[model samples]
Target: MGGVGHWVVIFAIGGAQAVLLALALWRRPVNRAANRVLAAWLGLVGLDLGVKAAFLAAPAPGLFRVLLFVGVFPFLYGSFFYLYVRTLTTARRLAWLDGVHLSGFAVAFAVGLPALLAAPDTNLANMQAWLAGAFPPPVPWYSPFLYAWSLSYVAAAVWRVLRFRREVRERRSDADRVSLHWVMAMAMGQVLIWGIAVVHDYVRPAGIGYFTIYGAVAVWACVLGYLGLMQATVAGDDTAEPGAPREVPPDPPAAPPAQDEDARLPEVQARLAGLMEDEAMYLAPALTIAQVARRSGYPEYLVSAAINRGFGCTFWDYINRQRIAAACRCLADASDTRTILDIAYACGFTSKSTFNSAFKRETGHTPSAWRARQAAA
Candidate 1:
């Protein structure tokens, strides 16, 4: 590591922040299960940072041994993140079977335990020799496995996030709020950090300090802590109602709805249009397909199909288009005199950021820019 003292200070501060964030997540009321998983991950990160800091500060044989032990713990981060994503997206409790993911960590830890029992002088000598650029016997045998496990699990988490986003769009108007985009960013950030660590480990090029790797980790810790706390508990497609029984897997494939049933889609489409245009259903910020179906006296699936086929868009796009149109009219009305945020709320957007994104996507201009253009024109 290049600035050993500075790196030590950085690691100490990061470790403290991570542990504090972990405690906060543990105490947070909402999203208890997912938060707890995140809390555990942060706690492990704190412990890892502390070990690295200690090793950097002293480089003692005992500290070096402990560092080796903690080194294998990185294997657990991927599993923790994957579990966190699963819990949030599925709203389900983790079962005992999930312990299988820890096997890699356990195996590595068991294999490296013998290093601690070796003679202290011999371990110190080896540590010194290795730091001095001499190859040694215990040559990071776990690197390949560690990289594969972590990357694969992170990929799986990203997959779940994508699926969750699609499902949310189909069900709720406030899909942007719970889309889990942050999870995708965080996972990719982890990949980047891992990439840096890999280059540091293998290349060991001059001027590219070890501290740079951990510094990226420290920054990532801050981002992860903030985003994980702010993310809401995403309800999945299979989420059941208060008194509803859990759905079981249907047996095998079934035929699609007949053409006769499809022929009535035009009527359903008209009803949906009337609901949006006349009833202003899109103005309900928390509107859902089930609510739309109830209002239209149609089944939810049929309502969804009508929106998909008749509107040539997903339910989310259809609803957001209506919202954007309403917002545009409001923006053009000089006499309305509502703040953009106020207009966003009135037009069914839950947040200014979400409103801004949808508005720009539909109009090719931000709300403010659009209003300015209309005023100038």
Candidate 2:
């Protein structure tokens, strides 16, 4: 506890910031449901940090009770994380069944309450001995089980985000605009924090004390706060609405039993080309495979298959290629006075970073470099 004062300051600052951010998120109008859950999670994390700070600054007489209370937070953290992701990805209201996720906290609270009635001196002695590293802390017997349970939910949340990314690409041309990469990074950060906690607690890693663990937690809180506020709801655009009823294109005529997919593959490819080349459908910023299928009078699957099998690229990639080609033409036009960002928007890219990356990837040069080369040539 020699450096305990420094850690107390770190925890207090992080806790205060987390609590403030949580309040701001709670009142945020956009993505109210998801934000509220995120708010609660952040608030809980802040409170947890505050408690740790207090306990470290002044060891409590009822150390057993405090430890038990803090131990139960993992269950809530995992449950809240899952629920927050669900609200963001699915936009569905939580059912009463969702309350089942909190049962672990309830059980742990009930089982540990009796220990709170133990004599203060006994709890204090245990706390002192534990702090001195001469004896193990009064950790609940179910702690290991709780860790596994929480990680299961974290794994589920990661799976959900990944699935969302895969599914969004099939439906939206501007999938990059609604990226969930931040969510993936945040989930990984949680896993790292959990790993550090486990190693510090069990392995007692050299130079990794309670301060190191809480310092990580504090950093994590700041990151979570920033990302949670910055993230947009999946429903930000009407065309990209997660809960919208997707329109299915009309079914095609039945083919003969001898006819394979190759029979209609040409037609699908032709229709896809017509949509992109003739209709300039790639210029729609919010264009989707469904829109292409509807315009081409082909099923979405057929359109997708044509893009994938014929062009050897995803619908997103094919569309980006078309856009990049159009952008190249624009970049090469000396008479076109539009800025790069203007060209990006005109080429159906909603984000400059996405546009720049796509342009560089496709042509091996940034948009500016491409323009300069064309000018010099």
Candidate 3:
């Protein structure tokens, strides 16, 4: 594609990102604060890409360059992204100290403000000089600092994702398909892009590498938008107190006496089965592994391990199995005149689609089909 075509493509991607951000903000997700933070991060990204596309297409001299200078720092974007992931995973609100992450951007902006406020001719002249390989601007000295800031936040984000994954294994059954994976992918993508930009700066000044980086960024925005649309939105109690126990990491199984180890497994299995069968704890739509552990008076890891070993499924699948079984009973009851949705809700399903899928997956037929078969029999 020609320059205009490329610019059009970038702008289109940026526009889509903005729309996705709006959708995320509009929805009342379970974690509203996290959703808003993510929307803000996406907004910054969209603004950055949109401005870059405009500059590329028009190539204005003074004001445009100043705008580019202000918009190009990825530090703020990195901080927002890290905070979004942290809040989403931890179910925590932003703290006052989080503002410190943007201090680098603030300092950089202040340092560059004089040039931006200089006479239009002087600003244009400086731009030409920089383009012509004259003395580098003060901004270049801060390049390493900016990169370091971005990398540190990306590292923090990755760490948070890893911790979240560990907690999910301990506390969630359907952990494999959770939304955290998308956040992990996005963080890794940022690392790769930033790494490439660093290499481009040191190895070659051809300026072509920047286009490649920006193009990758545009593509990343599209991917994020698509994932945001497809992924399930979290919906639950948003009143969790700050520093509340959001997740508990699984503890490693302690070594027992050789005979005790073998006997302990069956005991754990019995307790878990009793909790599900007798107590009917699976009826809670928001039931979690941690909750089950607390109810059964067992350690969270032991409960998860028991379910995994005895049922050969994740905590999510095991609970869903119980729910589906309960749903089957309701579906087969001729006296229960309730609708499918009502039955789904009674069986602890949060959404109709989730209920339908789980029912079909467990039983070889949809709820309606199963009901029809029961009537026929």
| Models sorted by lDDT, best on top | 1, 2, 3
Ranking by TM-score: 1, 2, 3
- lDDT agreement of model 1 with the native: 0.83
Report the alpha-carbon TM-score of model 3 versus the true structure. 0.65
Q: lDDT tens string, model 3, 142-210?
A: 778878888898889888888777666556644555537678778878888887778877786564465
lDDT by residue (tens digit), candidate 1, 238-344: 33333567666445334357685588789999998899899999999878888898899877777877888777788888899999999999999888898999999
Question: Number of backbone collisions per candidate, in order?
Answer: 0, 0, 2
| Clash count, candidate 2 | 0
366, model 2: CA deviation in Å? 3.5
Each candidate's lDDT (Cα)?
0.83, 0.80, 0.73
Model 2 C-alpha lDDT per residue in residues 1-377, reported as the tens digit of each score: 56688888899899898999999988876677787888999998898888877877887766445754775677688888899888888866578989998987777677666555557776667667656756443355665766787788899999998888877876788989666777777788888877887887679868887678778888888899898878765844223344568665466656434356657778889878787888899999989887888898876767777777788877788899999999999999999999999999998999999999999999999999999999999
| Maximum-lDDT candidate | 1
Question: Which 10 consecutive residues of model 1 have the lowest summed lDDT?
Answer: 235-244
Please give each candidate's TM-score: 0.88, 0.83, 0.65
